[model samples]
Every structure is written in C-alpha cells, then in structure tokens.
Target: MTTALRTDRYELTMLEAALRSGRAGRDCVFEVFGRRLPGGRRYGVLAGTGRVLDAITAFRFGQAELDWLADERVVDDATLAYLADYRFTGQVEGYREGEVYMPGSPLLTVRGTFAEAVLLETVVLSVLNYDSAVATAAARMVSAAEGHPIAEMGSRRTGEHAAVAAARAAYIAGFSATSNLEAGRTWGIPTMGTAAHAFTLLHDSEEEAFRAQVAALGVGTTLLVDTYDVRQGVETAVRVAGPQLGGVRLDSGDLPTLVRETRAQLDALGATGTRITVTSDLDEHAIAALRGTPVDAFGVGTSVVTGAGAPASGFVYKLVARRDGTGADGGAWKPVAKNSVGKRSVGGAKRAERLLRDGVAVAERVVVDDDGDGIPERDAADAARAEGLTARPLTATLMRDGEPDPQWLGPEGVRAARAHCAAAVGELPAAALRLSPGDPALPLVTA
Candidate 1:
C-alpha cells in the first residue's frame, strides 16, 4: 500500500514552496536526535529503522493518492508531478537498530535535496519516536524481570497496526514473544497465546474449559486459573490436566501473594513442575516487586504498548546543514540551527561513537562536522585512541542512493537487532539497569 498520505500536509506545502523558490534542489542534511530522555529514562533503544526504510520505499504517490490530493487541491500540478516521481534517492545513516542512545546521539541522518529530505521529516519522526518508546519501555521491563521471559500481549491495548509495531519493537528490546500473529509472520518474532478469560467463561464450567483446552492444545497449554476462584480453578485444572499441566496464568489479584500460594498449592497437588505466569496489569515496577516470587513469566499489555508512561520518545528531525548557495553542487555547506528559547538545536552533520572501557560503555562522543563532510574512519579511531579508551562506532550506512541495506531489512534483520540489543545493554554500566528515575546512564561529549 502506498504510504504517501501517511504524512502531514505541511510537508507537501513546504515542498511546493521550496520548488517555486528554486531552493528545493539545494543539497541538505537533516539529523534526528532527542533533546532529553523522556521520563528520566537511562537510555533509549533505537527501533523501527527497518520500518522507516520500508515506509520510505512504499512512499509512492499512486494514481489514487494523486487523484485525492488533486480533488482536495492539496498542491499545484507542478508539485503533483513531483510527487508522481517522488523517490528518496538519498543517503541515510544512523545508529543500528536496537542500539542504546543518549541525548544528542544523532540517531538518524538524511542527506538529500531540500525537497526530498523535507518531505520525510514527519514520517521519519513518527516511526522512530513511537517504536523507540516501546523499545525503551520493553528494555526496562526486561531488566526488571531479571531473566524471566516477557510476552507482548498489548495488541488489544493499542491501535491494530501500532500493536504489530509495538510487538516488533518489544521483541527487539529483549521481549521473548508476542501474541500478535502478524508480527510473527512479518518479522519472524515468536508468537504465543493460550486463551483469554472469555474462553473459560464460554464453557459450562471451568473444568469443561480446562478439559477442552487440554484436549485441543495438550496438557502443556497454560490454563487461565484465575477465572472464578484462584484456588478452586487451580484444583480443577490439576484434576483435568493432571500433574503434567504446562502452566497456569494468574490474570487478576495480588500477584506476589497469589503466585506464592499457587506454587504451594501446585506442589501439594503433585504438580510441582507447573509454572506460574502473571498478567495482571503488569508494569516494570510491578514485575520488579515480584522479584522473589514464583512467577515464571510475564504477559505485558497496556504498560508496554503505551510505553509505560511516556508514549513518545521526544525526538526531532531538523535541517542541520545545507548548501551555502541555491545551486545544488556549487556551494560549500553552511550550518543552520534554531535558537528558539528552550528548543535550540546543534547545527552540523555529526558522527557518534560509544566510548568503552573494559567492555563497559562510559560516554557518547558526538563529533560535529561543520563543513558537512563526515568524519573519516581513521580519524575517529585515532581520536578514540588518543582518549585512552576503545571506541565503538555507533552510526552505520542504512541506505545509499535510495537502496536500503538488506542486512538491516527482513526477518534476519530483526534477529540481528535483538542480538545487538542484548550486547548493547550488557555493555552499559551496572547502574544503567536500575529502574529508579535518574539521569541518562552515559553523558554526552560533543566535539
């Protein structure tokens, strides 16, 4: 499907204005970064770069879209012609998906003509902000779980499409599986779901429901045991599925107490091997509170898909550098920035690397190139060596000349991102894993 209309009107209007003013073809560099970590987050996990690439690829103005825009008089004929041929034949560089980021990290950089690049601001920010928020929240939950697997069951708590995206993002940030089937099919994420409360209520009794589920899904299926009475349901489940029942889900009540009681009951009933999974409106805090309990897994919904408490990762895309003159290839780059009160921006194309000591991340080093030429690999390495620390280059070439790097695209890309997230989070200082509100785990050092 065409994603051209998934943008704000101002993008096209600005494109039209720039085209008429003869500045649309000017070379431009746009960078995406966050001013501050939302909700005092220690770090932000980068997600949705693959989705952004897909969106950019599908950002075509088909006949239907052009017809609607013309009918609404959204732009003039000249702009419509431009839209008909709108392909982002540009270079895109950014931090790899699932990487941890701090303020001023320069998460994404788009280098293209003014017209092509300006039209991408809204779509780029929309994907990065929402996906990164879910990923950051999921990472926190993963840390709080302290090794228990988390299932993304928030499909019902968010928009249908957003639910799929959230599932993908959560998995990239260490979630074990998702209840969203589309996410599984699209991104190769593991899919998991047993049954909801309604399924239990559909039968003549809880015993009937347990029997039906076990018969269909085997004794290994997780039975919802909190449907009516927690203890009675467990007793009935054990009677039906026997001691070999795979697991029981507690979706309502005091989880810590209930989990302990359920474990004891299962042990007494000779179902000692049965695991306990909790799903009662759990957030990171709630999961942390159950640290020493017998809970085996977590099914997160509202708190995860909605980004815990911060739904958007306050990221902004700004034109940091452009050609000094209107000519596309005739002028040196001139840095540009906004100094509007508290909304100030840094004005240059940048290179970022993580400073590491003994495998622990110490700081984020951002080098601004005012001349618009990116930092060379040897120079970056030399600077890091001079600082007496190992440097890990954070940015990578995501796209070149309009073609996305397949390594960061498809199901394999998701798997790669998931592994990268694990490594990235592991490299942070031990204090970074704490759930308390505090400053970012690493300070930003700009050069």
Candidate 2:
C-alpha cells in the first residue's frame, strides 16, 4: 500500500502553487525538530527512524492515489501528472534511532526538490511523534526498574496497529519483552505472556485453572494468582505446579506489601525459586516505588503505550532553507524561517554533536551551515586549547535518493537501535536518571 495519500490537503495545495509558480523543482531543506521536550524530560530518545525510512520508501503514488486526487480535483492536470509519478528522491540525515536528543535538536533533515519533499511532512511527523513519545515513556520505566525486566503489555489499550509499534518502541528503550505477538514477528522483539485473571475465572475452580495451565503449558509457565484471594491463589498455584512453578503474577492490591508477603510465603512453602511478577497500572513512578521489593518483573499496559500522560512528542516539520529561484541565484541556498507571533522558527541547515567531558555527555552543540567538520573529540580538560570538549556526531545518513540505508531497515536495525539506546542513556549524568522534575540533563549550545 502506498502512503502517498497520508498527507495534509494543504500540502498538495502548496505543491500546486509551487508548480504553478514554476519553482516546484527548486531544491529545499526541510527539518524536523522539537522546540522543547514535553514535561521537561531530561532527554528524548529517538525512535521510529527506521519506520520513517520505511514510510518514505512506500510513499509512492500509484493509480489509486492519482485517481482519487483526480476525482477530488485537488489540483490541476499538471499537478495530477506530478502526483502520478511522485516519489521522494531525497537525502535524509538525522539522529540515529535510540540516540538521545534535547530541545532544538534537529531530529531529521530532508533535502530534495520542493515538490518531492513537501508532501512527506505529515506522515513523517506522525511516525516520529507517536513512536518517540512511547519510547521516551518506556525508557523512563526501564530506568525506574533499576535492572528488573519489563514487558510491554499495552496492546489492548491502544489501536491494533499502534500496539505493535508501541511494543517495538518499548523494546528499543530497554524493555525486555512485549505481550504483542505482531511486534515479535515483525521486529524480532521477545514476546511473553501469562494467563490473565479471566483465564483463572473461566475454569470451575482456581485449582482446576492452575492444574489445567500447568498440565498444558508446563510448570514453567507463569500463573495468575490474584483473581480471588492472592494468598490462597499463590498457595494453590504452588500446590498445583509444585516448587517447580515458573512464576506467580500479582495484579491488584498493595504491590510492595503484597510482593513482600508473597515472596515470604513462597519461600516458606518451598517454592523459593518461583518468580513473582507484578502487573497492575504500572507506570514509571509505580515501577520506581517497587524497586526495593522482591518483584521479578513487570507487565505494563496503558502507561507505556499511551506515553505515560504525554501522548505526543510535539515534533514540528518546517522548511528551514531553500533556493530562492531556479536561475543562477538558485544554486545558492538562502535560509528561510517563520516569524509568527508565538511560534517562531530557526533558519538554516544544521549539524549536531554531543559534547563529552571525562566520558560523560555534558552538552549538545549545533552548528549552523556547517560542512560537518570541526567537532570536538577529546576530554574538555585536555582540549582546553581547542574547542574544549569532545564532540560526538549524532546524525548519520539515513537515506540517499529514495533508498533507505540498509543498516537501519529491519529487525536487525531494531536490535541495533535498542543497543544504541542503552549506551546513550548510560552516558548521561547521574541526575538525568532522577524521576523528579529538573532542567535538561545537558545544555544545548548553538554555534
């Protein structure tokens, strides 16, 4: 299926106007960035870069898209013919998936003719906004878990398709597994699930349910132990599966207190090896509070998929620079920007790098009209005579012409991104991991 129609009407109108003005072929530079992190988040994890590349590859206009546009008469025949052959022959470079970003960080830059690039605005932002938001929230939960594994179980709380994407994003942010099977199949994410409370309630008795589950899935399968009395449920589960029971899940009540008592009971009952997983309204805060408990893992739902309260990453795509004309002057690009009252934009193409000091990230630096050179690369103290801080490049070539870089395009790409996310988070300052409100972990410097 082509994604050409997943664009705003105004984009086509603007394309028509540009075509009529005879400037549709002019080269342009469009950038995607967030003015600020939502809720003062210390840093934002870049997710969905691979998805955006995939969407770009599929942004073709076949007969169906052209026929629909023709019937709607959204543009003239000239524009219709243009749409008939539309494809994004552009160069895209930005932060790699799993990289950490901050306010004013240019997450993506698209360079192509105006007509080819303008139509991609909506779909690109849509992917980045939702996926990045979910990934950021999931990263917080992962941080709060303090090494305990977390599983994405929010598939029922969101749209069917979004659930799969959410699971992929969560896995990129350090989540160990997902409950969404599609994510496992599509992105190679680990999938895990146990019997829900309904499974226990469906059987004639809790013992029957446990016996059935054990007999079918083996004693290694996790069993729900909170449908009726949690204590009795645990006891019955241990009795049925014996000390070899894989795990028992707690779904309701005081998690910390219940987890402690349950662990003690399991130990006393000689089921000491049985794990204790918790799963009821688990968010970053709730997960943090349970750090001291004997909980084995967590199954999070609504919060992770819904971005834990901030549903959008608040990204905006804007034309930061473009050639002024098709004549000789066109070869020279001019920076463009919107000076609207409240919503202003920064002009010019940019390059970004992170400044490191003593192996820790300390600042983010952006250079305007840079030729991708002069980035610092040593400890700040040792480079006092130079730029004073080591600069690590953040952006990489994502696409050339219309072809996505093979490195960031499949299940293996998702795994690489997940590793990058872990390394990026590990480089941040200690304060960056605090669950409380604070300023951005690293200051942004525009050079």
Candidate 3:
C-alpha cells in the first residue's frame, strides 16, 4: 500500500494559544455560515457534529502548539493576548443533528467572544464540512442499498484524520460498519475487515492461504474470490470451507456478472447459504446498478468517503449576523456582508425552514433575524411539521461562563446522523439521487 504523511498545520498553533494562558471563562460567539451549492440546495443535513467534536478535542492548545505559535507569531501581540487567555463561555443553539437544513441555516453557533470563538473556526469547519459532505453522499448511497449492509474501507484514499472522520460520516449516513480502526476506537463504530490480495500472495498457494485464514479466523471469515482466477478462487474456497462457508467476496472484474456466476457456482456446490459481497471501483452509480443482484453487502472505498464523486462542496464560514458594536434593539445591530459575486452571504442571524408535504421534506427556505420567534409557515404545511421546523443551528455556548460543560459529545456522536438518514429515507426525492446533471435542484429561498 502506498503511504504518505498527514498534516495539521494550524491546529498546534491555535491550541498552543489556548494552552498558554488556558483561561476559563471568556465570552465568545462562533457561528456556522454557508450558502447553497452552485445550483440552489433547498435541503441539507446537519451532518458532521461528531467529527467537529473530534477536532475541538484536538484543539487542546498544548505545549507543542504553543511553541509553534510563538515561533511563528502568526498573530499580532493583541491577537496573541486573546489566544493565551482562551476558553469559551457562552451558550449555543442549532438544529439538532440529522435535521434537514437549508441555505442560511445556522448549522452551529458558538457563543464565546473574540479569542474563544474565532480560533475554533478553522478546526471545526475542517471536520464538519469534510465529514458532512461525505455523510450526505453516504446517505444517498445507503438509501439506494435498501437496507443492505455497507462496509467502509476508504482509509487509503484520504488523509488520516479525514479517513477517521469519513468513517464517522458514513456511519451517520446509515452505513453499517467501517474498516477504519481509528474510527472504531474513537467513535465506537463496528470495525470489519476482509483479506487483501497481499494476504493471499503471501501464501505458497491460494488454497494454503485460504486454509490458514479459515483455521485462524473460522469458516465465517469471508474469502476473497478474485486473486488469480475468480472461479478457481471460489472453488478453492468451497473445497476448504465446505457448504457452510460464511461468504465469498469479489473485489475485481464486472461485479454484476461476477455475483451472478458466483451465486450460481455457490448454489451448485450446495453453498447457497453463503453470502456474496462486492467491491472495487464502486460509487453510488455503481451500487445503484446492482439493484436485484445476489450481492449481500458492498465495500465502498473512495467515492463514498470523498462524497459520491463530488469531491467537496464550496461551503464557507462567514459573519452572517453578529452583534456588531451598534445600538438598535438595545445594542448595535447593523447587518454586515462581504459583497462578492458567487460568494456573497446574507448579513444577520438566520434560520432554516424544512417544508414538508405530507410527512416528507419537500424543500428548505431561509429566514434571518435576531429573536426567539420561530420561522413563519408557508402556504402549504405538512401535517407532521405544522409546528414549524426551523434550524438556528449556531449559538455561542460550547464553553460557557468561563468553564466548559462536561456534556461534550463523544466520538460516536454520528449515530444520530445515521438515525436521521434512516428517517429521511422515504422523504428524499428519488431524482435527487441520480448522478446526472439535470434533476430538480434542492430549492433554496432567502428572505
């Protein structure tokens, strides 16, 4: 396997600042602000809170980070002063994880001031945006699978931290388990593994290798049936493990054809009870192609982790609504915006309304303000959401009143994503799952 170094350039710098002074109760406000995709996206999933939490923990501001920050002095003296005394003290509010969201929806809000909130932006977005994108893609794939088990094995394709977060995201999107050990350790996800070609190649013969593995791992161990000869591998696997062999996995060649022939062979050999799994160059489109095949599970690597072939959505963080030093509603309340084309953002706190027709999500719209009032209802309201489903996903209370609450989410927090993804199954527009360019876009209206 190819290998390379993974990097987190700014984390140490910021954490050092947090570590240096390590102050407890500083007020700050952190907000998540991003807009629609190029083609207006009406609905979004609150995808990556679990992964975001990971980075926050990593933001420990230890001695190493402090040394780097001092060595470079990335910020001025005043900025450094803020960093040394960093600790968020405020409250936060946002749409619950897995809730359907929309453009201008505050995915999250951090309520600590200056140092506390500002430093967290880079790290939090790094985890949330990346993992959320992967989770969104995985949700679509899981929907297509119709309850088939999904195995994630994309660690080789991404950075180390990204690999871990991808596993969490995929889980949140309803995947059954991951091949990432780190994810298993950090997030409590079920970890699974299948023999690679290397294992087979290490043995004197494929038969000998299969025997050794079955002996060590039991008959339930899945046999990789595509090393040298697909049919030969399957036959050898049967000879060694008999009719009760747990499963035969195909990693190469045409998947549908392989499953058909492989199933026929297994059945003829009285191994009908054995399951079939497929992997290799697969994506959402590929998985969709195997609708009624005998394939029992899918091992998705690159595409699912990287976002169903959509590498990354251009999501950004902006100060859409801030309490700029002004005096309007008892304080300064001027809306500020960075008016650039294609990247313009609304100024002011925002909310998202997930409109439902019947009991399913139809689209999402945005409402901006600074108040406790909920979102306004539209002309047609689904019975399930008549009470209104607005998301003010950002607030400023991760670290509050100079001390952090022990209520921080653990690594496995993405379970909620998985549950929500399951809940949204029947609600997703089928056409939206297509890989083609021309389908109805997720509608996004800004007010």
RMSD of each: 1.2, 2.4, 5.7
| Model 3: residue 74 alpha-carbon error in angstroms | 2.9
The model with the greatest lDDT is 1
What does candidate 1's lDDT look like per residue over 1-447, in tens digits?
978898999999999999899989988999999999998889999999999998888889999999999999999999999999999999999999999999889999999999989988989999999999999999999999999999999998999999999999999999999999999999999999999999999999999999999999999999999989999999999999999999999999988999999999999999999999999889999999999998899999999999999999999999999986765364998989999999999998998999998889999999888888766435777777898888999989999998999999989999999999999999999899888889999999987
Residue 309, candidate 2: Cα error in Å is 0.4
Where is the poorest 10-residue window by lDDT in model 1?
373-382
Where's the lowest-lDDT run of ten residues in candidate 3?
1-10
Ranking by lDDT: 1, 2, 3
What is the descending TM-score order? 1, 2, 3
User: lDDT score, residue 43, model 1?
Assistant: 91
**Residue 106 Cα positional deviation in candidate 3, in Å, after optimal superposition:** 2.8
Q: After superposition, how far is residue 124 of candidate 2 from its true place, in Å?
A: 0.2
Tens-place lDDT per residue, model 3, 213-235, is: 99999998899989999999999
Candidate 2 lDDT, 1-447, residue by residue in tens? 788888899999999999998988888889999988888788889899999999999998888778888899988899988888887888999999999999889899999889999999999999999999999999999999999999999999999989999999999999999988999999999999868878888899999999999999999999999899999999999999999899999989999999999999999999999999999999999999998899999999999999999889999999888886765546667888899986798888887888887779998877677322223343333332275567788878999988899999889999999999999999899999887877889998876
TM-score of each: 0.98, 0.96, 0.82
Best by the TM-score measure = 1
Model 1 CA lDDT for position 236: 98
